[model samples]
Target: MCAVSDDVQISVRKMDMRYRHETLLKDLNFDVHTQDVFVIMGESGCGKSTLLRHMIGLTRPRHGDIFYQGKSFWHCGPEQREEMMQHFGVMYQNGALWTSMTLVENVALPLKQFTTLTRRKIKHAVEFKLALVGLDGYGDYYPAELSGGMRKRAAIARAMALDPKILFFDEPSAGLDPINSKRLDELLLELRDNFGATIVVVTHELDSIFSIANNSIFIEPKVKSIIGRGNPKKLLETTDNPKIIEFLTRGERYE
Candidate 1:
């Protein structure tokens, strides 16, 4: 585990994200400090995942920039972008693993492609990553062979295969039961505490929001911008915006 640094690790500056001709978020600005559990949240049509895509360099915004450690994400050269990607570990909402491949093969893919580690070393690294995610002996199993929560854990192990500095999660609790969801939250906190990873999660689950998010940006679809930013708990307690309050409490008034 690396020691925490108070540096600003990620900055979304005046970004305007879009889908085809329709604008999604405009002039969106936020900062992710090192080791912070930052969340992107809002309603169903709010483009939360779209914003994450921009941050991961999958989509180019129509305006403004995203910065990681002082480098412009959209303006960087391909090589630079490739270098930046080495610092990222993304776990999709579905736990996107190939059905044909075993968990071992899946996790080993990154180490095999990115590093020149020997066969034995790669195996050890894969084992270590799987173990880290509490999947110690499930290497030979396929995605279908595991339970839903186990599959998510396996996907997480794959994401950690390269030991990324920033971990991005998209709706991590979407399909899990409350118990499993809580387990994932604990694992995320463990990653932040143990590996010092800066976590950015795109989610609308109130349980997850309260459990994991230290800071967050609530995307308002109608307004096409962030409606709320700060600690999730504080926003839930004190925000005057009806949309934000409705979101935090699921349409119930905050008492």
Candidate 2:
């Protein structure tokens, strides 16, 4: 077991992933510090989402192990994995809220599944989570009744239901407008400041990256590996790699 540190919540070493003969990621290594907003950005098919899956244990690495709180999750038994998973909350690219369930019911599902709390207690907990995401009074609405941004907020509320230590968001602003995207970014900052939750976001949005990322990693498609890692502003100012420069100054002409 690796030594645990309050700052380093997740550590990945020499990780590799492949499907049959096609390699997706190679020699990947990174660490996510506690209460830090770590954004992973890359072009489509560069394996950003795949990396997120591996980090969250939805998929296992073909060659390397992932460590959570200094424990090797891939090498651990089912019970151990279960124990580790309880510390994580994941928000998918599409929000993934249940259409049939009301917002409150969706937020309360995780607690219901994992805890023995009474309905009243669960309701109270759910309300707290909804409030955290600025959805305090919309608990009775179903997914179909909410707007896109509202759906994303409701999804975030559900993800927080269990009070996870680490929150993973896959393209949290995928379908939202600029205004809503900024709101989500603000919510992320609030989450880190108020709850001290470590956030790992997988996004390619330039605005999102510049606005919220404290530290970031860039996956390069050609290398099928991480080409950059550091503060987004620092990387943008120093890196002359055409791709990195292009991505950093997405809408403006380089000349």
Candidate 3:
């Protein structure tokens, strides 16, 4: 097993990215410390998703390194990278559950593929994860049978299937109603506390960011780099940078 010191979970170093001829972000550097709810916040079309894909090895950065638990994800050999990937769990903008699969089956997929656990044991674990996400008895339901909130919860259960060390969420609250979005936020905090997982969230939701983020960085669209870095709440109250303040305060000063 690999050992990561308790202080840092992942590090982004001098990352440069471009699309066609347009540079999206350049020299992006940040560290997501262990067990933090780290937010990557920016307005829409800021390439947050692109950066995330690069971290997950879906896209190669033009220049830079993303370190996972002190191991260079870009520099590692295939076998080493594959070993590193086993520790990640990701949830997309939409729930992204298979419409045909029951909730338990969806959650069980990861465990069945990754571990030697028997079917019986996987079933037990699936039920536990389902219950954790407040879907204790709905594991038999298909994705299409559940409401939007329930589908998101089911997807979260699946993400937690392998007890991942780090969880990545892309716009977790994108389509939910306000109430469901709040519930999802609560669930995220619960997951972080219960699992002590490092969570990297890519979102532009101001309410969610203030409520959940322990640390964050705002991507600057104009400069093609990060403009602000720190606790969202503090930055909201203290930042003089117009873009950072405007983004966080929604152009309204704290009154």
Question: What lDDT does each candidate get?
Answer: 0.88, 0.87, 0.86
Per-residue CA lDDT of candidate 3, range 31-79, in tens?
9998899999888999898888787777778988888877899877888
Candidate 3 Cα lDDT to native: 0.86
Question: In every candidate, how many clashes are there?
Answer: 0, 0, 0
Candidate 2 ranges beyond 4 A from true positions: 1-6, 19-21, 251-255
- Against the hidden reference, what TM-scores do the models get? 0.92, 0.92, 0.90
Model 1 residue 183 CA deviation (Å) reads: 1.9
Which pairs clash inside model 1?
A: none
Candidate 3 wrong stretches, greater than 4 Å: 1-6
Best by lDDT: 1
- Residue 145 CA error for candidate 3 (Å)? 3.3
Candidate 2, residue 238: lDDT: 84
Which 10 consecutive residues of model 2 have the lowest summed lDDT? 246-255
